[model samples]
Target chain A: MRNLIDILDLTTSEIDELVAVANDIIESPQKYAHKCAGKKLATLFFEPSTRTRLSFEAAMYELGGNVLGFSEAQSSSSAKGESVADTVKVVGYYADIIAMRHPKEGAPLVASMNAGIPVINAGDGGHNHPTQTLTDLLTINREKGRFDNLTVGFCGDLKFGRTVHSLIGALSRYKNVKFVLISPKELTLPEYIIKEVIEKNNIEFVETTNLEEVMGQLDILYMTRVQRERFFNEQDYIRLKDSYILTPEKLENAKEDMCILHPLPRVNEIAVAVDNDKRAKYFEQAKNGKYIRMALILKLLEVE
Target chain B: MTISPIENGIVLDHITAGKGMELYKALGLAELDCLVAVINNAYSIKMPGGRKDIIKIDAEIELNLDIIGYFDPGITVNVIKNGVNTKLPKIDPPKEIKNLIKCKNPRCITSVEQELPHIFKLTDSENKVYRCIYCESKAK
Candidate 1:
């Protein structure tokens, strides 16, 4: 009866259970190697994404499950004008479970309605990415020891970053979490998020243009890319691109134990100089992505 | 007061007066050259406290005939042939519907530029929104 479409769908206890399962998998990888043996995971990436698609495939393979599905719409019946509903009806017959990534905002929810098996939304168009939020949760729990009473700084494109929105939605459920939002004025978090999620819950959060000023106070500095394409004026991007960068000089002011995380394929928002720093856990975060996905696949299929 | 009859027409009667105008606008009938006989505030009766407004539309647009049942099933349709009224029995919404309208979410797969059929189930007719049974996205 459960589908992993959005972070809010998972209760705090369920999140804790998933993180516990992921941690267990990390410790004893061999025991759960075949948790999904003889099962099929259909990765229906309607839009092309090399990173997320490959991660889902790797997760299924590591769980001893076979992966089948298209990486692009052109490669599937979508090219032949088949509808999402009919596609799910057909794909459900073949795969035990489905992991879908679509350019459309609500395609996965559509698929879930008709799919007899569970559906996982890998990513939807500026909508949500719940599994990534799970990965972040696991990483924070392991590193920081708890979700409550922590000050987390979110940097770069907070406006359109579905990950940030999902993470905030998930984190708001916890107790005493403070947010330090660092972004260009243009890329500030959307009002629906501010009114509907943040301020509505009375979670203490402050917006700032200066990243270094708040570096020392953060428990986790979540970095997101500031793409040139998201900018209307080139000069505005030029002025703000360096505003959110996490460099060695920047980390000098940051607490030595402060964790730096990024949903990968990151541009220069976090400088290469900071990669060697002990606090940089983005690559580790990427690896954790696979394990958490393994946990999600097993949980959704009710395999173990 | 009664208006002159057309040689052949369909009369939608007992529509809650103002609602006939809404149905007329929804069907874009104002620009048409067809004879539209709108009799508003022409009927009144004591129902405990006060009376109600009612109107009639005399035309043969079959789609509009179907729409009358959709908008307000209380209205009755009578096919008038040279002033002879032949009452057509009422119709109601189907118990089960496969698809209704395309979802409004731009990123919804239904909005994608493909020949795929867009389908929706009426979730809330009052709000005029449909819940895409696939995406679960509310489309207005």
Candidate 2:
């Protein structure tokens, strides 16, 4: 009955419950294999995201559910000029649950309005991505053993990073959590977000361009790519790209137990050399993404 | 410009000055066979320094409710008769809004599809930002 369109739609308790369920599944994977035996998950991805699409498929598989739907708009009825609402309505009859990703923002919202099944927004343009927020929450819970009282540092493209915006909204609900926003001036978090979410919540947060300066103080370092195309001035992007790159030298000042994360398909933003570090949790984070999704699938299917 | 009071027409109130013309254009009032009196700078003794703008549209055709809601909610429409202000009912925004205005995000569901209703939730009236419920895209 619930739709996972935005992070705000999920209450603090619901997220806590999801995190708990995700952790339970992680602890005992064999116990939840047939949780969704006859259910089907339709992933209607208008845009291509290999990592996200694959994770959803893998999640459904692990939950003993079948996965259907397209990875791109070219493969779906959307190519035939079908409205999102109509596509979802037809798909809802065929599937028990729907996970949709479209280049258009609010595509899932449109789908949810018409679809009878529970709708999950996989990714929608440059807008909010709630499932990734769930993954991040599960990752933080798994690694740190708690979500409260942590100094999480977000580096690179905060302005256009939907995951960053969604995660910040999720974490703002936690206790004693402070955000250290590290990004280039051009790719800083949008003012509307800062004004609406951060300032309104009275959450402790700071904006700084110097990642090295604050590297030692963070409990979680989330690094995202800074693409050249996102820059209006090519020269500025070329200058700042290498500086945001996470190397062993950058981790020199970082906390011994600090965890580093990236919502994968990572370009050179994170040096592969840091993969061996004891604190590198991006790979584990990626795996946990599948597990949390498995938990989500099982929970949503049981509602019907 | 000087204009006499409409004998039988609708008077719009609380319209931010200079917005009447924009609404006029948006409504395409000129094309219609109606007497559209635009009071750009009218003397309002109620206001400080007694200066305000009022618009009087005298027409047989009824105003488009959605068009009014889309343009300005502050605008109050009153049906006038025999130099007396008659019933002035507020235009409530549609319970289920259909496409008319556009979402701020061009890559939103409302924008890409012609069939889907272009929906926006009025957020801050002072800022004039409508938050697209689907995408959370803010537009002025």
| Poorest lDDT segment (10 consecutive residues) of candidate 1 chain A | A191-200
- Worst 10 contiguous positions by lDDT, candidate 1 chain B: B46-55
What is the model-wide C-alpha lDDT for candidate 2? 0.84
Clash totals in order: 7, 1
True contacts kept of 1: 0.71
Candidate 1: residue A24 lDDT (0-100):
92
Q: How well is candidate 2 docked (DockQ)?
A: 0.78
Clashing pairs in 1: A104-B107, A105-B107, A109-B134, A109-B135, A110-B134, A110-B135, B10-B59
Q: What TM-score against the true fold does each predicted structure earn?
A: 0.76, 0.90
Candidate 1's chain A scores what TM-score? 0.98
* lDDT, candidate 2, A1-304, per-residue tens: 8788998888988888888888888889888888888889999999898878999999999888899999889998889988898899999999999999999888898888999999998989989788888888899988898888999999999999999999999888888989999999999999998887888788899999999999988999999999999998889988899989999999999999999999887889999999999999998988888988887777677632
Per-residue lDDT, model 2, residue B15, is 64
Tens digits of per-residue lDDT, candidate 1, B1-140, equal 66776657776666674566776675566876877756655555532223333333455555554345446666667777877888877765422233334567766666774554555555544444445654546545
